[model samples]
Target: MSARRSARRDLRRLSGVALTSLWLTSLGLPAVFSAPVSAGAAGSWVGDAPSVRLYTPGREVVSQPFLPPGTPMSAEITSVSWRFTPPPGSARLETRLCHPQRCLWLATPRGQSRALAGLAATGPFVMRFRLPESARPSAPLRIEGLQLIVNYH
Candidate 1:
């Protein structure tokens, strides 16, 4: 009888974990359940926060990887998704796409106050933060974890 009860308890625990993973996947956030939660060090970017505070009117290069001269990529960004914390306190998130020439630079706005209303643009955005102040300054807003969801052909 004792052995049977122990087995039953173990089964329930496993079941719960499975259910949780499934639920997260359904929400399009499988990173929480996967072992490799992040691409940066230690599976997350919580240790570092944005240092730039003044939102400026210049273009700040975020991530632009150079291929092996002749490398090819047919990736068309369908959408993007990001998760952050130490979060905006009371401020919201906005998406800014720096469309320069033929390059699209994705940028997240950083702010120090709750009134970051002028720091972002209101539109159909995901995983992108847009700050209104368009001047080049130091880092301000800090993001914990950001994930960009893309569909490749």
Candidate 2:
């Protein structure tokens, strides 16, 4: 009798899951157990650890220009964020994202992320950085990473 009761409990739980899945599917949503959609085609792109080193003070360091592979030209960039550790000092670091036509300055202090409203990813972007005179030339400034978050139709 106990064994039969346990089986019924298990069956009830399974049926509950199936019913939820069916309801979600009816609403044009993916089931909970379904495979996740791929973000490569249209989703956020995070580029990590470019790890650029800046030697000269006040001289601009430009990274090798790049973009998320398979990203279409028509894709619109909704926002962008940067992550890095600033060289230890009062020296302020300047950063920018540049394409062929223009550049957008990332003006957040302490390496915080910022948003770019409806900025189209027209082409590949290169990271440009410059340190103030207060920066110690003896110590190279390391830009840890950069992340580009994009959304598209």
Candidate 3:
């Protein structure tokens, strides 16, 4: 009877792992357990879009129609820079990037107690980073945008 119970427990554990892998694969994310995650030692840029692709070395591109809120975006970003021009009189803008195991967030009008308003026509909002080595084509990550408002403004 003890042997039978042990076998049953092992079967249940295996079933759970199989189910998790299937779900991730269905979503197009790399198998989380298949390998160790690492960032690329050599800098590289991977563009984030409906179909993510690696960009040419040292080339930079800006996205149009800044991202909307609650979406996750991922890119194999390299050492580079980018500029953003929010609409005039618009509130603050928020941006974020993430990988399977990590996330980074940035907000505009940084460090000032006063709320940011009336954005200029253009400004430096560069994102520079090396792509994660373990990155595999996952469900196309998304960049989410949020507009912040200040009572004083």
Candidate 4:
């Protein structure tokens, strides 16, 4: 009798789980029952130059590579994003992100903030800035409140 009760209980539990998964699927959500959750180390840091008042065309200003936000010495980076004041007029500002191994350039600005993709690394990473010679700013171009955020798991 005890063994029969245990088997019935197990069937009920399995049926409940299957029903829950089907309900979640109907709602277009993942069935996360007993799934392992991944932990992430993600944070933002101030650039070595918080702001640049001097606008030197065609010169690359490099910031010292900053340490990872927490304990992510060898974690794979998943994303990069930035916030900064855009250069005035037609001046196109560019930013470069580098790990010891390689670099990636963020896209030209359509606004003050952007989330960029295609960066993968385990980092202590460096940042570089440039205003190209082709840019024709009617006013002085100043970069302010430059910040970088790194995300990894």
Best by TM-score: 2
lDDT of 4 by residue, 1-153 (tens): 699999999999999999999999999999986654455545443333356543567878766566654544545555666566664454666777666767767675322222333334446666677878786555656666666666555
Give me the overall lDDT of model 4. Answer: 0.61
Put down candidate 1 lDDT per residue, 1-153, tens digits, no spaces.
699999999999989988988888899986354464232221111112232232333323242221112112322232323334424452443443322222233333432211212121211123334444443325565544433222212
TM-score for each predicted model, relative to the true structure: 0.27, 0.57, 0.23, 0.52
Model 1: weakest 10-residue lDDT segment is: 40-49
What lDDT score is found at residue 97 in candidate 4? 64
Which structure is stronger by TM-score: 1 or 3?
1
Estimate the lDDT of model 1: 0.36
Candidate 3 residues 8-88, lDDT tens each? Answer: 999999899899989999999866775543433222222223212223322222333223232113322222222333344
Better-scoring candidate (lDDT), 1 or 4: 4
Ranking by lDDT: 2, 4, 1, 3
- Residue 118, model 2: Cα distance from true site in angstroms: 4.0
lDDT, each prediction: 0.36, 0.66, 0.35, 0.61
- Candidate 4, residue 116: the lDDT equals 32
Ranking by TM-score: 2, 4, 1, 3
- Tell me the spans in candidate 2 whose CA falls farther than 4 Å from its real position: 1-42, 109-116
Residue 131 lDDT (model 4): 73
Each candidate's clash count? 16, 0, 4, 0
In model 1, the runs with Cα more than 4 Å from the true position are 1-72, 75-79, 86-88, 97-140
